[model samples]
Target: MGKKETIRKKSPPPTNQPVKDVYPTPPPLPVKAPNNGRKNGSTTTGNNCASTTTKDLWDDLFDGGYRADVTIKTDNGDIIYAHANVLGMASPVLRGMLKRAKGCGEKKPISIHGVHQDAVRVFIRFLYSSCYENEEMKEFVVPLLVLSHAYNVPRLKRVVEVELEHGLLNTENVVDIFQLSLLCNAPRLTLISHRMILKNFKAVVATKGWSSMRNSHPGLEKELLESVIEEENNQKEKIRKSKEQKIYLELFEAMEALVHICRDGCRTIGPHDKDFTQNQAPCKYRACKGLELLVRHFAGCKLRVPGGCIHCKRMWRLLELHSRLCADSKVCRVPLCRNFKEKIRKQSKKDEIKWKLLVKKILRTKRIRGSVSFLVSSNSISS
Candidate 1:
């Protein structure tokens, strides 16, 4: 019998397995954080890197020596290995993506496009441990914000927003930052950027970002223009109201001075019964001296009749205002107080409305000026 030939079935060549790409261990990035004030022997390397005794383990795991379950494919085609558990726990968005990938038969590398790979690397490091470099933050803050928003990482988003607002927000970048803030849904940053743009509108308009925004986002440009015009109108309105308020306050002070002169005597003028001694001290009211001079002029001026002299007309208007505000016109010491009240009552509807509005304004101004106590006492004296 011929020796039975043993046909050895060669085992299938070893299944070709692609080599996993490993990123070099990045030095710990220095994160800006308040110091504990206690001296520690551990050297600070990079932002958020473990500075404690177990730092080596953290570095090994993050630098890809330990078991990394998922790979991140950056826009530049760099492969970064990461642990699914850490990323999933940090972000629900990432958890869902990881789950979706696992559910599929093939685990394709998660692609993060439209950003620099270094920014992606920094982002992944933050997921593993919360830390980052200051210079990198300055250079890649906007990209980080975009990534944070896309990945639904609120903490990183807030950090980037704060860094931009505090350090980078300026006339040069305000317009650009404002647009990004809206896209990222960062309200505080939006408000700050809006205010900065408004405050330096001319400078902001001159920036390249503003020009680009105007061309690309005509709606935003129109909205900002409307806001600026509205802000200008508001400022002008405030100024006009301020001037009107001053006039009303002056009228109120004049009324008080008139009452003081009629009821009690000022330094030079008063009712017939009150003493006008030359040695009396000056009145406390600010308008006393001025009103005393006006009364002296009205008494002596040959054109004392109505519609005659401007000074007399001014005095007549003052007396009319006093009559409108007076509680008791019958026995009021002010000359023509009753006669003015009678004329006011017989005034045309237009004149009546005009005087009433003036009276209302004076009273409102008095209340706002905190002179209620003084007016109350004056009313009591009249009664």
Candidate 2:
């Protein structure tokens, strides 16, 4: 009944007072269930955070296994990377060339060490993609040739040669393709291209000249000459059978007459005369006189005069006199002699009228005889 007994009684009465069971109040009826019916922090449900952690670990392991150093620098200033084995097989120079050739920017560089940039790029694309079916390739053939030679890629070189051959076959590109083929030392390409070039032999040979061709491609010069001869023969055959046979025949006769006058004028003038020889500068008095004599002879043919007629003979003699007199006089040399020039001019005018009449007669004759059997025969021989 002292202080201890009072304290004990107070504590005991506190425990027995209603004895309310203190069970957890059912977790406050969960404000909202976790999404997808997953219980928070419950092992029965899948552990998304743990799964994410496991994935991260696997990723680290996979990354570690696959990592490699594959970067390389190229001679032309290109930086690239490949697998170790690929690098081993590739030549150091080639690797550099490829990188520089491909370049490393959004805008590609123009040319590599003197080669056109687009050409090198095309080559790189072929190396990597194994295809070169672009139109740009046509203009970039020389650069491709350079690349092939440098890389020692025989297959690629062969492909370029094929493309060059095809290009040469196109009449429009024949000259340029032929030139490139010769420069690149492409024998087969040159041979194939030569055939196409022969089609325009007269125009090409005349403009480019045999001397220039000989100097540039001495090896092919003889061959080209032969081809030109063949083409000329074929052209002659065609002319023989053409509807314009009369026109062609007259032209040939005119040319022959012109040649005879030139030769006769030169012989009459004498080689010692500055105007008459190769020693004289071109376009001089002798040259003009020679050309004038040829023109006069051609005109005389249209006038229906015999080759040895007095008028033709007189015209030839006058042309020779004109050359001898006009050798040093610039004015008369350019315009020819005033009196002789007037006579030749009048004759030329009359000859032109006669030629026109003859052309009309030929056309009239062709219309009346509608059979083109001659043309067929000519075409067969020419073709």
Q: Clashes in each model (backbone N, CA, C under 3 Å)?
A: 8, 3
> Which model scores highest in lDDT?
1
Q: What TM-score does model 2 achieve against the real structure? A: 0.32
Backbone clash pairs for candidate 1 read 28-45, 28-46, 29-46, 29-47, 30-46, 30-47, 31-47, 48-131
Tens digits of per-residue lDDT for model 2, 207-274: 54445667877877777778788888998988766756565443333333333343334434422233
What would the per-residue lDDT of candidate 1 be over residues 1-383, giving only the tens digit for each residue?
99999999967545573333234566899765543332222233556354543443454578863667788888778999888888889888888888777423334357788999999988887776566667777788778888899999988887777777777778887888889889989999999999888889999999999999989999999999999999889999999988998999888888888888888988767878887777788678998888889999999999999899999999999998887777777767778888986897688989787877877776777789776424333442221
Candidate 2: 10-residue stretch with minimal lDDT: 374-383
